[model samples]
Target: MHLNRFDDLAADVSRGLARRTSRRSFTSKVGVWLFGAVAAPLLLPVARGRAEDRYAGEEGDPRSCDYWRYCATNGYLCECCGGSANECPPGTTMSALSWIGTCRNPADGKNYLISYNDCCGTAQCNRCSCSRHESETPVYRAGTANDIHWCSANESTAINCTVAVVLGAAEDEV
Candidate 1:
């Protein structure tokens, strides 16, 4: 009645376009999701800790998370194992599994290590450092209840520690 012949052609073209796009972009969709897995954390401008778990001072003993001490350059902290770079963060030079790239202090040529918290470990669930929306700071798990929260204590300039090394020590980096 009203040029129905072209209607079917238009419908066919629409389906064809959809099918082509789906097939061609299948991997890209998957890759984007995969890339987001790690990109979320690395892209953080400044990995800020939660207010509930904020370090007041060296209260519990040797303050574990030293902000001023490590003073990460590339948004990374330094976690050492028995004062050895080998036992430090995964990418640190001192770590035996020094698979990570090397980065030295701009002021001191001495090699430093980028620290890493056990975001995924046995004690706690794998905290996805990714997010769909941007927030003011990074979120961490820190409650004495069943769900425990902890981060990698790196070498920092802080004279005192708010927390102590309870996990992932030199002998325990297995």
Candidate 2:
């Protein structure tokens, strides 16, 4: 019986593979692959928490720039740049000075004081870029103006992203 060139090549490859690897080694490799496939899903929740879970009592997505705390935010969102809305990303520093904004919470019908702090020491995050001009003051008013570079005061002038942190509930204006 004559075998085709394809069959002969396949037989030669299989013989070479069998000569190099034992049955036990092949079984162990297959076992490892199966174990990895089975274990991947179990590790997902530990890696990334659900978005709604992260913002338990908040009204909107923390990753979005339209969140209630970001009424006057004017940069990339930290939540979308590997950090939470109130935290800076790894390797970045939060600005010492922050522009304050009073945003009303749609869920509670009360105003909250939001501190717009910029994360510096890295290039711009370029993700989830958002700018809301609501109640922004003129550029001359540095404390309330969102146009100023908050990262300029940091050791690194590179603006990475912005975090909208809730300082407290705003007092009612008399």
Candidate 3:
């Protein structure tokens, strides 16, 4: 009796699976394909517009750390040193690690979160030490603090943080 009950259960499950597989009719498949084809083109422009909106910035002197892009900047400006706003100096390397800061872009009137990674393997760029702190804390709170030297993790010697370069930007969380 138990064996017969098990066989009946197996047959019921097999029938259920067969029904599920057969439910996707030809009309349903065509409807789904048609919906995707019609919606993709209409959605693409909106997606592109949102991406463009996140990258808005104001025209300002890059040499000054208080430039529109450097709203929450915490270290020396790379432009003041031998490097541009987004690049490290000739000999120095841009560190993979970085700190996050939220800077308001005057162009779009939106706050953008930027990654400020230090350029390692060079002397500290002592020129423009712009300590514009937004969410930054003291070195005791190393996770959020940009004042602490970040190059020590990448460089062998105890080199301090040199130029701070804008690695990337995105929309602010809040």
* Model 2, C-alpha of 96: deviation from truth (Å): 0.2
Candidate 3: which stretches are off by over 4 Å? 1-57, 138-143, 156-173
Residue range 100-143, candidate 1, lDDT tens digits: 11223222333333332221111221111111111112224122
* Model 3 TM-score on a 0 to 1 scale: 0.56
* RMSD list, candidates in order: 19.4, 17.8, 21.4
lDDT of 3 by residue, 1-174 (tens): 377754453345333223222223233233323333544454335323433222235444565443556655566677667877777877787777777766666666666666777777767667665555666667777655776666767844333234444444555454
Top TM-score prediction, candidate number: 2
Model 3: clashing residue pairs?
none
Candidate 3 — worst ten consecutive residues by lDDT sum? 16-25
> Could you say which candidate leads in lDDT?
2
Off by over 4 Å in 1: 1-98, 110-174
lDDT of each: 0.24, 0.71, 0.55
Better-scoring candidate (lDDT), 1 or 3: 3
**How many residue pairs clash in all the candidates, one count each?**
14, 0, 0
Global lDDT of model 3: 0.55
Q: Candidate 1, TM-score vs. the true structure? A: 0.17
